[model samples]
Target: MVLEREILPYFQWLLGGEGLGLGALPQFGLVMLGLALLALIGSYLFAAARYGPLGGGDLVFQTVSSGFREMWEISPRRIWALARLAVKEAWRRRVVVALLVFFVILLFASWFLRTDHQDPAKLYISFVSTATTYLVLGIALLLSAFSLPSDFKTKTIYTVVTKPVRAGEIILGRIIGFSLVGTALLAVMALCSYVFVNRSLDHSHQVEEQSLRHDSLGGEVLGYQGRTTLDASHRHDVQLNNENNGQALGNHGHSHSITARGDGHVVSAAEGIMRARVPRWGKLKFKDRQGVEKELGVNVGNEWTYRSFIEGNTQGAAIWTFEEINESLDPAGEGLKIGLIVRVFRTHKGIIGEAIGGAFQVRNPETGVQSELTFFDAQDAKISEITIPRKLVGTDNSELDLFKDLASNGRLEIVVQCLQRGQYFGFAQPDCYLRLPEGSATWNYVKVYLSIWVQMVIVTSIGVAASAVLSGPVAMMLTVSFVVLGFFREFFVGVATGTEYGGGPVESLVRLITQMNVISPLEAGASTSLIKGVDAVLQSLMLSVAQVLPDFSAFSTANFAAFGFSVPTDRVLQDLTTCLAYVAGLAVIGYFLLRTREVAK
Candidate 1:
């Protein structure tokens, strides 16, 4: 899969420093413990100032001992019963109204979505997945954030408090109930979206009889070529032999399978139009015009620098080093199928609209033995496919086996270069790949939905934790702020660490006021010293908050289904682990918060 943002594998992510990894658990625990101690000290100071030192000490001891006691005394039966009650309460509140809201939004959604889009599958997938995600998360936020608070408002919580139900159980019960409700809604939405997208994109073109041409000399009937009638705002060029069988060429990222009919063939959409393309990706590095190896290629003047360009016609080339390229990668022995999403850029559009020439070369990493250049016209914004046969004629015109000569120790380097001197080819790490056997598109869709589900659970957990201590509106706002901040946590972390050029929040603000560029150094003085001093404290606070907030963006895999790539299993596992961690941590925190509240007591 082409990862726009890099993600670590399960083990690496679990044990790494980035995000809420298990390796950082000890440090996080220490931080939590330190905060707890600070809170205890703060309470004692307030109590001592009002009462006495001995009285303050006694109160702190009671609070600590009771909080632990309340948590430990949780009964499974009581928890389940409370969960059911919360579920009933949610139903009574008509949470399923969320589904109606979704349906109503979707009813008028067609006004914005264009049926004639070139990539209908992508557009539809993105729309449905994004819509479902926001709707479900919004429901979770409202339901979880307001459930306990509303109970308190109505004094309904007093009845439960008078019963054997503990404060800890209430928090856990609310989380479980809200999660169950959200899960049911998510499943329904996923099903509806599946049907909706398929219905909207499903279309077939009729054979244009007048457009058909027969290759006949005299009376002999030969093959025929024709154009298909317009359907879904597009048409296709088609050809068939006397047997009345042929495939339609690909257009709009899809092709048609012509079913032979009496007079002409009926065109049907091909299976791969919406498929899970399992691709074996390789690590990409660039060789400069001077033939020096580098991590990145030239940055073409694009605002989005996801793709880098290489100078054409020179020794400059974008190379992918593929590891684990064995006979298994090509079990059929037909060849290794290479797929490319090329970004063609031009210094000048020489012929107004002409494809630039590009070439591919495979080299043995160990022996430096390279294959002869395989050339093709590089079209802009199109996926190009090429097959490398098992047998090959090398640049020296010597016979060679693709496996034996080119791939050394299962490592092969494929170089892509723009053949036109004035032209350039842009590539990201995921832009080129070795196509493997396709996986089930259904399973891929399920995985993306699973990602959305994890996100919902996380949001609900955050809201519940906040609501345990704050009012409903405040809790909702806090949850929303956390989610929004989570999206930019990495950048926030960067600023906190002084890695970003403009510095921290205050320093950046100063830069904005002075109209100074990020690269310039601020003039050193007491004002600057004071600015730095204040920014340091702010940075420290930002860093702490960044670590606690969930990285919500990591849970989105809708792009996987849209791009036709199967979602990576490791990422799903990583997300699941992250969600469970948040749920567990927040449950503990919420339990303590609820225990301190008068309503719960």
Candidate 2:
């Protein structure tokens, strides 16, 4: 439900084959290499102007030789000593007080974080993760930006420079030291956040014995239906049988155990309410009212085109072709769980506040034979689940097994149709998926924090690199500006690639002055040609900048966790690799910057 689009694996996303796939590394390396070459040529030209041609060559050779020598002869012990000193210095600066602040916020968090919230888990996780991210990133930026600059300001850097400590060592030492501190802070906070979210969402319910009613057919008792005692401001509608009296419907993101207590049912073990449901996504296609296959369905006049609409009381339906069906999908031998999140768009006021009715049925892809419809009511944007019985009834009233008769040759076609007139069902490809199984909720929460940590690493590196050549306040400004730009990296790409409206910056300004629509082209003339020419150049520059920016959107995975979906392992690996690459590049850049900076030379 959180994922509106199908996620390609990391390798596929980066156009790499497999394993620790090369993602943006090829292009990133080329850019860095080009910049390094430019820096070398520029340094040599500056030296020549200042110290004559022959002396310039000597200076250049000495700089390059010393750089290589320092790299090869770097001492880990010396770096560790300096890193330990940094840790002591940070303690002296009262960095540990940030954790106290985090604790205080958690203590008072319940005042605003309502326990009765419809999705308590999502609310708690969002608040905790967001608060922790801002706190940690703020601490990192402030600490790293001021650390080296303050040493230089107090002339304490002179003491360290007198020793054999290499410029590279100083930079790496500071990065590692601050990273360790941030890691410690993050770990404690992660544990506390985990506890806070779980505790805030923790509650249990008991079965309401008085509410039990017999589910009987032909004067025989089949099962019992009842309601659970209210807890956490909500109750569950339960259905159970005496044979295996443990199954119950999920009410608040989880289901409770309903066991037979003598003649009565007992509901207990309210576990796994906030869960990560592993889903196997299928390929989505559309069928028009005339029953013709199409690539996409009708767009129902919405600006955000994430979901397409299927008209009601017609042949319009969304078809999902699921492949590689196997017994593992139904390991318990129970029916397959079909999870759906759909949006109901109503044009008629018939039966106000009632949910729209929709039908789901499976078809054989090869034989085109379809099963009888399974109906469920859908509310707007609400997630509904239905279990397709192991034995399905065909349209011809023949009982057919789900695996053998309908799901032909390991492929299953599920069709979704809206039954009411003047109502529409809108859904994206990810709106419907077969729920496979659940993973650890705690593990999923940790993955969310892992993403936050990567972001912290990136911000800290930016701060340190900027501080290498800039004053504390100015470096803070630079890092902040970079982070702001990073958050809008997608928007920048959109404009640069002309996917979004309003052309390039120059063209946008032109449109603003003339009050022209973003979609409209500039009026043809000599002046327009000149404007467009400048825009073209600007677009290329914009693209180059966009490619270099940190992808902040990709680093955030709260939605996936919040909506009870497992974050892909490849995504985590790709982000960690990206963080490492950024750190390595920043460390090198910081070394060179300090080498040529005023404090050193």
Candidate 3:
């Protein structure tokens, strides 16, 4: 005869390991593609610098060079001349300078803010950028509009015009001058800000380092320990036999116990009569057969069987065990210990294990005592157990990473058995420290400054172009109106009150203004169904008149940058083209108006 050895079953999981299917490349490529495009444009512009117009380069330089022209020949001069003029003028303009200085201070102070917080830089950037743009645009517009107009009023243009200078060239020169002054001030501010931000980062890094050091000290000097105690409220409910899984009474006066016998057999003690059924293989037996009895609220299913061990009359609290299985009579008609199945139940307050499923054997080194126990999952209708069984041995197994996979399972949690449980859940503390940077790289700050500068230039251009065509006071009024419109124009409409289709109440007019261009033909058609009461007025305007506004929200990217949302590059290009086209068209109209009008006395 051959020897029969124990065999361990290995389950081959059919799950496919996580693999890449090319989804990652698209996201990564998009950012790389954008940076590539930016680089290409920069290179192209740099290469074409010696060529004709560097886009709109002539405007401001011409304005300043014309100021010193001899009224005879229109010849070229170094561009830096106008740049110098702007700085001198900006220095004299205390109002604008004060605002710029204040904003610079704010920028520097922003570095001190808690950068570790989510989106703080984004919020700070958006607010500061928008405000800085307004300031720069206002000052630039005021300077540019008054630049030539003031000369015209003083009749200084006649002298300058009679010289070699052209009117266009003069306007260009003034723009260049102001841009230079603005650029220098911006450069200084950027340097300071970049220094501050780097210093802040250094300080943050130092603090983190010190915190790690302190954690090491804490771990070494003041030993710590911890424990996970199950609250009495969320205890386990169980029984000893196969009948009482669901019908077990809640918090009744009853208890059950299980004991291990010397013959490697488990004896369950309950209040039911000791009955045994013979199985095909063996006869069932218990150490104490007289303890088995039935009490109250007994129910059984295939999964669980037990005596209704807890009495219905008893109160306060109690626990029990249960099982669910029947044994068949053998050929010899002898009682057998086979066919017993273990089941666990959840009570309203505690969990009960009827027949212990499997025993986790543990030994205490100090006492030299061994114990066998079975764990249950639920104690009440709502409660669930979070138990982890660990077998302790001589050497510490805590550092070993075995059984980590079992910990991830929802019900079958695994935890290490430690000599001392204190190290189980302790969090290390940190230290306090600061550090500073020692360099002059300020590219980010410069970019912020440049972005603000360009936006202001655009805004001032709009206002100046208007002022160039209108009378002084009218120009001022128009400038202020447009500026106000830029910031608060949404208030004039009712869409600010609610959504067009009552999707929800609008938080503010600003959100409504931003959505002005989100037009869909289907939406236009859908508007008819939204005709109800006073809201109908809003619907009508949204479907018709409000479409004419510049969608000041379209010009805004606050939500995109501040809220960490996508702003499609195509949309940026489209909106930028639209705004430029509109500005140009408006300026043309104003030019015609100016050309036809004679100066009033």
Best by lDDT: 1
- Native-to-model Cα distance after best TM-score fit, residue 146 in candidate 2, in Å: 1.2
**Candidate 1 per-residue lDDT over residues 74-100, each given as its tens digit:** 888888888888789889989889899
Specify the poorest-scoring 10-residue window by lDDT in model 2: 14-23
Against the true structure, whose TM-score is highest?
Answer: 1
User: lDDT tens digits, residues 1-601, model 3?
Assistant: 0001111111111111235323322423444455446534554454357544564245324422443353334344622444365456567766456455655667566555554443343444455556555555666667655654665588654654455434334444555576665565555544544444333322100011111111125345322111111121211133222211111111211122323244222312221111111111111111111223223223422222222212121220111211211122112323212122222232322223432222222223233233333333222211111222232222333321112222122112111111111111100000000011111223333433544554554555555566555656667676666556555445444453443333222322323655643233223344434433334555555434333334443355443333222333333444444445444434333333333324331
Clashes of each: 0, 0, 72
> How many times do residue backbones clash in model 3?
72
Reference-based TM-score of each model: 0.92, 0.89, 0.36
Question: Which of candidates 2 and 3 reaches a greater TM-score?
Answer: 2
In model 2, which residue pairs have backbone atoms overlapping below 3 Å? none
- Model 2 per-residue lDDT tens digits across residues 100-202: 9999999999888876777777788788888988899888899889988999899999888788898889888888888888888999999998888877787
**Model 1 clash number:** 0
